[model samples]
Target chain A: MTLNASRQRLLGPDSLKPLNEGFEVIGAFNPGAVRVDKETVLLVRVAEKPLAVRSGFVGLPRVVSGGSVSVDWTPEVELDLRDKRVVRRKADGIARLTSLSHLRVFRRREGGSGWTPGPALLPETSAEEYGIEDPRITTIDGLHWITYVAVSRHGAATALASTTDFVAFERHGVIFPPENKDVVLFPRMIEGMHVALHRPTTRTDFCRPEIWLARSPDLLHWGQHQPILCGLNPWESERVGAGPPPIQVDEGWLVIYHGCGPSQGSEEVGAYCAGAALLDLNDPTRIVSRSVQPTMRPAVEFERNGFVPNVVFPTGLIDHGARLSVYYGAADTAVGLADLSRDELLSSLN
Target chain B: MTLNASRQRLLGPDSLKPLNEGFEVIGAFNPGAVRVDKETVLLVRVAEKPLAVRSGFVGLPRVVSGGSVSVDWTPEVELDLRDKRVVRRKADGIARLTSLSHLRVFRRREGGSGWTPGPALLPETSAEEYGIEDPRITTIDGLHWITYVAVSRHGAATALASTTDFVAFERHGVIFPPENKDVVLFPRMIEGMHVALHRPTTRTDFCRPEIWLARSPDLLHWGQHQPILCGLNPWESERVGAGPPPIQVDEGWLVIYHGCGPSQGSEEVGAYCAGAALLDLNDPTRIVSRSVQPTMRPAVEFERNGFVPNVVFPTGLIDHGARLSVYYGAADTAVGLADLSRDELLSSLN
Candidate 1:
C-alpha cells in the first residue's frame, strides 16, 4: 500500500512489437537492470505459447520445436496449455512443463525517447535444455554479469553469463546447482568476494523453502552456503525468494524480494507480494534490518488478473533524489512502475 | 515404559509351517482380534516376498500373486524390488507394493496350548486387487463385522466384510473410496450408527496425513467425514493412523493408535510408536482425552530391526480384566506382545 497506485507505464511486453507479431507473448516482466555507459539496460524474461487455431493438435512450429526453442508438447496430442507460464502435457495423468522461456533486453538512455528492444538471447548450451528466465544483472569493474534461471531435465539451476556491450556475451555456465533458483548477485564485490542471495526449493527432504547466501572469488565457483533469510511470518509461510540486485545506500544495501503464501482457494493459486530487507554493505550476508510486512501487494486490477494472479514481482528499481521508481511485473503480465520516497523506504525497514 | 516388555508369544510365522514350506513369510504381524464363543480369533496380515532367491531376480509366487493373495510387482518383467515393501518400476519411475499381503485367521481358546493357523482368506473380488491388510473387527450382537484396507488399481480403500465361525466370510465389497486405509470399526453402534476410524493419504491438494472418522447407517455406506486426530507434536508430525478397534470403557472408548515421526537418519525411515486416546461414547469424533506422550515406542531390539527399521506398529489389542494385551508388529517383521494395566492406559490419556 505504500507504493503509489498512479504512475506512468514503463517498458512492457508491447514494446517488442516485432517479436509479438510472430509469437504469442505470454508475459514480459522481471527485468534485470544494469546502468551501462550512462544507459539503463534490462534483460527481461519473455514467455510465449504456441498459437494454434485451425489444427487440432499441440506443439510449436517446426522452426521452434527443438534445441533452445523447444516445444513441450508433441504434435497430434491433446494437451492443456491454458496456464501461460507453463505448457503441460498430461499423457500419463500428471502435468509436466514443456515450454521454453528466453531473455530479451530493453535499453533506455537516461533522457532517451522511451526504450528500444535488443536481440532475443536464446539458449546456447545443453545446460539450458528448457530455457533461461528472470535475469538479474550485476556490473563489476567493467563487465556486466547476468544471473538467470536455467531450466532443463537436470532441474532448475542458477546460471551465470557476462556481457560487455549487450551484443557479445560470455557464458560462464551454471554457478549454482539444480533445485535452486531466484539468485541475485551483489552489484559490487564485498571484501573482494562476490556475494549472492538465492532460494533453494526442497519438496521432500526439507519442509520449508529457505533463502541462502553464498560467496565466491570467481562467479562460476560458489561456496560457503549459509541461510540469511527464511519464511518467518504467515505472509511468507510458503516461500521467500530473492528479487533484484541489492541497491547501495548510505545506510546499507536495500533489497526487495518476493514472498509467496498458500492461497485460500487451490494449490494452483498463490498470494505473491514484494518485501524489503536491508543488508550490510561490507558483508552482504549480514542482514541489518527487514520489513515485517510486505511493501507492495496485488492491489490493482492489472496485478490481480493475468497469467498468475495476485502478484506484484519487483525485478528492477531506480532511485531519484526524492522519488524511487520500482519497476515490477504486474500479475506476471505487464511491466509496472511504483513510486516511493527515498526516506519512506529507509524508514520502513524494521 | 508403561507396558511390560515380556509376555508369552502367541503366533508368529512358525505356526504356518505348512505354508512356509514353499512360500517365504516376510512378516506375520498386525493382527485384528475378537472374542467369539469364548475363543479369541485373529485376522492377521501376512506379507511374503518371493522364495526363488537362487537367481538374482526378485518377485512373488503365483499363490500369493493374485486373488485375496496379491503380489504388487508383475513377474513377467524384470523389475527391481530391493526395498522389500515397494516394487519400483523404472519405466514410469513409480514404486508399488513389492510384498503381497493377505488376511489369515489364527485362533486360540481362552486356555489353549498354543496358537493354530486357519484358512488364508484369499481376495475373492476385483476390488481387493492388491490384498487386504490390517483388519479391525467389531462384534455386534452375534455377527463379527470386519473392516480392513483394500488395495487395488483404483487405490487403497476401506473394505467391509463379516464372519461368524471364522470359516465363512461374506464380502460386502469396498465401503470407502480410494487414497484411504487403516480402517478400524467400533465395537458397537453409538446411538444406532456405526462409527469408524480411517487414515487417508493425500497426494497434492492437501499436505498433511490425517486420521478421519465417519458414521454409517449401514456397513456398506459411510459418510460424515471428519478429522478426529492429527499430528500435534513433533514426534507424530509425519502421520497418525488408527490401530486396534476402540475398546469400550467406563471413562470412554480407550483407543490405542500408531503415530509416526521422522527418523533420526532420514525422512524415508520413520519411527512408529503407539499412543492412547479417549473418545466420547456417543460421538466418536468428540475426543475426550489424548495422551501427550507415546505409550510405546520402537524400543526393543525386535521392534528396531525388521523389514522396516524402528517401527512398532500396533494393530491388535485384547482387553483382559485389569490387564490389556497389545499385539503389535515388531520392526515390521514379527508379532510382539506387551501387557498394560487398564488403569495405566486411562491415566495416560490427558
Candidate 2:
C-alpha cells in the first residue's frame, strides 16, 4: 500500500478532431478515460453505419420483448453464437439476439464528420445482445457522466448515461446492474455523495470476484454495497480492472488499476500495468493504501503490439501539477503513450 | 425457516466423565457436536499423547529444526496428499512445535475410578503448544461456553473456554486464534450481543474456505465480519462445517452442519446432515433463509458405522416440548438417535 507514480498516454489519441458525424468511429474499447475541461475526454468507441446491406447485416436495433426483454437488431436476425443458455434462461428461451454485434460510442468533436456515434444509451437493455462496451468520462455538479458496458439478450450490466453537452443522453437505467463491470466514477463529491468502483461476480465457492464500494446520494440510487478488494491474491488472481478516472492525490483517492492473468471468459491475458488504492476521501469505502505492484506496465511497441495481445488499456488521466498523462489502448488497434512523475506512481504502492 | 421440534439431549459421548486423574484417558476423536443447557456436550476429537520418537516411531512428531516445526509422521505424509500448498505448509509446520506440548482434559465424573482424566489445563501462555482439542459447547445467558481448536506455535485458533459447572474451565485466551476452526455458538443472544460461527482458512487463492460472521460486543470483542455461508454447489464443493448448536425455531437459526467430500486429507467421505439458516435475531448478519437439503442424514447402522465412515456428529440439541431430540456422534464411535418434527424440520425448509 503506497502508490504514487503516474504517466502513460494516448490522451488526445492523435491530434484530436474526429466526429465528422459520418457516424461509426471506434476505440472506446474499455475507454472511460476522463479528464474533462483541460481536455482528454473520449468515450468514443462508436459503431453505427447502415443505409443499404440488409442480409450481409444492416444496423441492428429493434428489441421489444415483454419480461426478460432484449431483441434489438435490424439486420433481420442471423446471429446466435450458440446461445450459452439463452441469456441465463427463464420464462422461455426468447431468441432474436446478437451479443458481440459490434460495440459503440464516439466523441472527439470540434466540428467535423469524423466521429459522432454516441446515443444508443441503454438501447434495448439486456446487453444489446452485445453492443454497448466501455465509456468512463466523469464531471459532476455540471453533469457529463458516462460509465458504459450494457451487453444484452439479458446479461452484463454497468450503464449510466447523463450529458450536458456531448449532444444529449439521459438513460441511467442500470447504475450497477447484474454481475457488474469495471465502473469508475469518483471525480468529485466524495462526501456530498457519488463514489464508485465496483466488481460484484460471485456465484459462490466462497467468492472470487472482488472490488466493491457504492454510495450515491442521487447519481441514481446505489447505497453502501461495501466489500472492497479480495480476489484470490498475488496481484489480483485473475480479475481486477478500472484504470483511469480516479486520481486526486495529495495523500488519498488514487485508483489506477488493471490486474489480469487467468481469466477465460472476457479474454484476459494480463499486463496493462498500473495499480493503486488510497481511498477514504470521506469514506470512498475506506481502503487508503494499496498497490501490491504495477505502476505502469506494457513497456511499448504501441503498448506491446491488434485486437488483443499484451495490452495497455488506460482510458485517461492528465494530472498537470507534476505532469502525469496516461491515455492507453494499444492492442485493440491504436492509441498509446506514456510518461511519469507524480511521485513515480505513488512510489509503487509500498 | 420454521424449526421448533423438541425433546432433549444436550451432551453425550457419555456426557463428560473421564477424571481418570492421571492424564491417559483416550476417546477424544472429533467431538464437534454442540448444544448447552441441561448438558449434552462433546467436542471430543482428542488425540493427545504423542511428543517425540522419530526413528523407532513411538508417538510421531519429529521435524525439529530447519525442517520447519515438524509433524511429518511420514508415510510420506500420506503420499503427498494432493499438494494443498504442501498440506498448508505441513499444517503450519507442525503447529510451531506442537503449540508447546503437555496438556490434559478428560471427564466422565460419577465417583472416582469410574472415570478419571482431569488436571492439566496448564500452559499459562504460548497457546498450550498443541493442547486444546475438539470442544464445542454453548450456553449463553447463564454462562457455560467452550469452543476449542487452539494448537500453538501460532496456528489453528478458535478457543474460548468457559464453565459455570462441568468443573473448572474459565480461560478465554485464544478465542479464535490462528487460521481459525469450526467455532459455533448461537444458543441465544442474537440482538443483544454474542453470536459466533467462525471458520477462517483463507490461505490465499482469492478467498475460498469461508463461513464467517463475528458479532460480540462483549462475548469478548468480536465485530461484524460476515460471509455467512459460501462454497456452494455439489453438496458443498468440499469443506464446510458448523453443524450443532444453532437451533432456535419460530422460523430461522437451525445450523446442523458437517460437509466434506473430495478427500485425501484425513481420508474424507461424507454423511451427517442437517442444514438451516435464518438469522437476524437483531441482525446476526441478516441471512433469513437457506438450507436446500440435509436435515439429518447418514441413515442407520449407528449412522453409517464408525472410526470415520459416514459420520453423524451433532454435539447436542433438546427442545422436548414433544419432538426434536438429536444427540448424534455415531461414526467417531457411539451415542446416536434421531427424531423429527419441529414441524418436520420446518417442512424441510420449504
| DockQ leader | 2
- How well is each residue in B1-350 modelled by candidate 2, as lDDT tens digits? 32333322222334443332322323334443333343343435433333344663223232233322234355434332332111222322232221122223334423332334444443344444445555667777677687766554334455577776555778766544345567788877766666787765532212245566665645554534445675454454455667556767666676666555454356545444546556655665566666666565556664565545566566555566447656555665555546656666656653
Q: List ranges where model 2 is wrong by over 4 Å.
A: A1-211, A214-238, A242-269, A273-297, A301-350, B1-211, B216-238, B244-256, B259-350
**Residue A199 in model 2: lDDT:** 65
DockQ of the candidate models in sequence: 0.01, 0.02
Considering just the first chain, candidate 1 attains a TM-score of 0.87
* All candidates: CA RMSD (Å): 23.9, 22.9
Give interface RMSD (Å), model 1.
Answer: 22.5
Count backbone overlaps in model 1: 3
Candidate 1, residue A170: lDDT: 81
Instruction: Report iRMS values in order.
Output: 22.5, 15.3
- Cα error, candidate 2, residue A305 (Å): 14
**Positional deviation of B47 in candidate 2, in angstroms?**
39
